[model samples]
Target: MSKLENIRIEGIFIKEEGRKATLKFDMPFYADSQPVKWADSGYNSISLEIDIFDIHYLEIKT
Candidate 1:
């Protein structure tokens, strides 16, 4: 399986009080792949890791 891309969030809560928050993540990719950058040939699915108290939702493009 391919490694999932990582997204860094600035803070857990931004004026909101809760254990969860919404996030925006870029599609997983490898920089070494030229086709993925130029031809755009990357996989659509990716594994994600989140903080212990945080939740995540990902929307991938087909």
Candidate 2:
């Protein structure tokens, strides 16, 4: 499994029928420490979507 750090969330979508949720991110990178710079030439331009199904519970703390 790949570990992604400091994920910047771009969008969120939810499906009420299936109790599913999707998280969208742009150019996510795996780093041991520190956040990656967006302007870095080494970074790849990629889009990521994570889906969660049958979520039993969720809490949002801001």
Candidate 3:
């Protein structure tokens, strides 16, 4: 499994007709189960897009 630590939400979009949603993250990093070593870590400048499907309940908090 992968882990995303200290990630910031950049954007969110929902499609009612398609019953899908997307979450965008900034400053994301790819890491495994091992302990994260910041000294050797590298930052990803690209944004991460996570596509989620299926309908249920949705909640948003700021």
TM-score of decoy 1: 0.23
For each candidate, what is the lDDT? 0.43, 0.71, 0.73
lDDT of 3 by residue, 20-40 (tens): 999999755544443445334
The residue-level lDDT of candidate 1 at 6 comes to 61
RMSD of each: 10.8, 6.6, 6.2
- Any residue pairs clashing in model 2, and if so which? none
Output the better candidate (1/2) by TM-score: 2
Q: Per-residue alpha-carbon lDDT of model 1 for 1-62, expressed as tens digits?
A: 96644643333332234455544444455345444554564555433334434434433353
Which residue pairs clash in candidate 1?
Answer: none
Which 10-residue window in model 3 sums to the lowest lDDT?
A: 30-39
Local accuracy of candidate 2 as per-residue lDDT tens digits, 1-62: 97767667798887887488988987555444534574465654567898999988776543
lDDT value for model 1: 0.43
Pairwise lDDT winner, candidates 1 and 3: 3
lDDT of 2: 0.71
